[model samples]
Target chain A: MDINILLVDDEADFVETMVKRFGIRKMPIDSAKSGQEALTSLAAKDYDVIILDVRMPGMDGLETLKLIRARAPLTEVIMLTGHASLEAGMQGMNMGAYDYVLKPADFDDLLDKVRKAFERKQLNAKARKQGA
Target chain B: MPRPANRAPEPASDPHGDPKGILARATGARLWKDHSLLLWAHFLVPPVLAALVVAATFATPILAGILAAIVLGIAAVSARGLLSRLSQTEEARLALNTQLIQSQKLAAIGELSAGIAHEINNPIAIIAQEAEWAAHLIGEAEKGCSADFAEVKDSLREVRAQVDRCKNITHKLLDFARKREPVLQDVDVVRIIEDMARLVDKEASYKNVTLVRSLPQDLPKLRTDAPLLRQVVLNLMTNALHAVDTGGRIEVSALADDEALEICIKDNGCGIAPENIDKIFNPFFTTKPPGQGTGLGLSMCHTLVDGMKGKISVASKPGQGAAFTVRLPRRV
Candidate 1:
């Protein structure tokens, strides 16, 4: 099954590269420049996983995560950061982000985490359906 | 032996039915061993005294009357003793029941607040969006006409700031409510503690507080979730930093034994008040001035530690500083 994915980051170059990389892997992905834009995209579509950057221009990644979780609980989020801030990492994990990845993240590792997150989302959806 | 017609047959003959028999035998043996003297006294004393009273009554009336009075006195004393013991047991049970109810109540409150926080998030988001939109419209109007809308802009700013604060509280509430199942991996616990300590080092220095690390080089690696442990350790260290006074000292130490790994954060500052110590880990139980603290930090730490299958505890005296310890199993 195709895993609908969204990447949210403020850095234009980083988002561009990520989009191209995923495209090369035959997995087309959507991108958003900021938390506000991410929320707008989320409102329109159901994404299985989101690659969110911790540091954003307007609303930071942690704040964005809270809203995303509230809106789409089944959607898993993986936090991306340029610097290793322990504080941010703690907050991201506590806020229910699927995982935290440091910048200069290895492509293979990121792919592995994305696949894992997508699997969790699928399981969550199945569980909810069964519960209902 | 023939059983009575109204009596049920016994299961004691079946070998597989020996469980109940064994339990009964064990309990009977224990009772005999612990209270043999009392049991013997209860059976023998009453009849022996009755015989003696019968003999004395036949021989002399005064002797029989004195013996009967002594027996009555003994009975009264024993009855009082039994009554007091029964009340003590009742009191103990009541205390236990109260403790159980208190914990259950806290759990319910935690769940309710989480639900409320989740429901409140949507409205708070709309309010924030409307505030932002209003500010945007005001800016556009100013561009078209020469007008100073500084007061209006300031009010909008305050509105946005307040919304952000509300967002913070709700987000924390959601976090506290989040049920994170730990994904176990081999983790270097000492490294996690050191990393978190580094995060708090600059803040500690700014307050002239000394942050000490006493992690041993040979401490064993733990099998647990890394991020959750890191969150717990960092939160505790931050709390210790906040507790200490200027030029005070905070110590972060780790040690391991056969079964569990223990990390302690000790602070030498104004100690916890005796009355507030128990409530410190309760959500929304903060001593800080209004709007200064959400009081979720320690409680969140408590929840996280519990999720990791660890124990978190505090030892404090009113004037003698406080120490917080987290104990995690070597393999979890």
Candidate 2:
């Protein structure tokens, strides 16, 4: 399966830049502006992993994480936060997030985290198939 | 504003300065005695001075000079005693102010705890869902599947949930730590004051300070930030009640005069010293001793009132009682 991923954030320039970077590397990337939109995309498409931003105007990242866990348990979520509060990072980890990477994120670090989250999702899917 | 619950240092039972806790308790009695002594000496001295003058006029100069020395000695002794008594009164006032500071700090911590509870609740729900999903998914997996993946999922989810709970509570505790924000707002004075009084009433029930509202029903609203205004009202009312003996009364009233809305909270407490009337609103200035006050309540109030593009003034004469008047711009 092509490794599918969703990058959700409100910053247009940041999103476009990341999309271009991913495109150059031929990495699969889909993006959304808010938590609600991210959820809608997940419902229609089966992404292996998701990258979510915590602080947004509406339906913040934490709330989005809860909805995602409830509706699409198999998809792993990697949190992206511009504000580096240890408490937020800790909470993200506690909510079964693959990991929360801080911004201005080292693109290489995010890619590494994204790869790990995809592998975790793949493992879960394989287990589910075998169990079924 | 919410305050951190745990950050409130426990009732500093052994406050650094004094563990014995007795300073100027007999201030009134001492002052009365000093004044009585002064009166007696004044009465006795006048008669003696008259006798000395008469003696001098009648050619008994030596007798008159001896009388003059005695009168001067009496005046010096009484003056020293009065000054000492006054200093003691000043020290006692300082202690009461300290107690007020401690109370404000504890209040701040309680506010923080409430905010922390709100922050933690969501992550806990997510953690639970993730664990349940992992559990059932693993249960349905192949009998010979890699147990390592299963172990990682279970351990990580458990670790994450516990950490999230702690972080949520701590973050809230920090966020809600209430302190004086020098920011002012255009507030609806009548509404804000009433809201504050209502909160104080619920809390005052435990202290038994009877809260009386004497507000003009149709007074124009004032321009003030609701949150800061609410806090200033709360601190003053709470401070008044603390000084008021149980079964004492606190009156909260609002009125308007031309361009300003005037709100007053009057309490029949221990009252304030004439010297202290100016110091009460100074930061860290309190009449209540350590562990009871942070000395910031009135200071915070003073700052809030001033920042609102208005004025806050207090009127009191020791023993007659104290009244705080706050004026804010009338909302159009």
Which candidate should be chosen as best, given lDDT against the real structure? Answer: 1
- Model 2, which residues run further than 4 Å from truth? A1-132, B1-186
Candidate 1 chain B, poorest ten consecutive residues by summed lDDT: B3-12
Winner by DockQ:
1
lDDT at B12 for candidate 2? 42
Question: lDDT by residue for model 2 over B77-189, one digit each (tens)?
Answer: 76777577677777766765675464454444344444555566557667667767766676667356755565656686676677665554444334334332223233456
| Candidate 1: Cα lDDT at B198 | 63
Q: How close is chain B to the truth by TM-score, in each candidate?
A: 0.70, 0.45
DockQ for every model comes to 0.15, 0.02
Candidate 1: where are CA atoms >4 Å away? A1-90, A96-132, B1-99, B140-147, B330-332
Task: Give the C-alpha miss distance for residue B155 in model 2, angstroms.
Answer: 35
Clashing pairs in 1: none
Give the per-residue lDDT digits (tens) of candidate 2, residues A41-64.
998998888899999889999889
lDDT of each: 0.79, 0.67
Cα lDDT tens digits, model 1, B1-332, are: 22122222222232222433434343333323465687577556766777888899999999999988877776666567557655665565565455445445555666777777778888999999999999999999999999999999999999999999999998788666766556666677887777567667767778899999998999998988666787788788878877888999999999999989999999997889999987888889988899988989888887788778777889999877899999998866
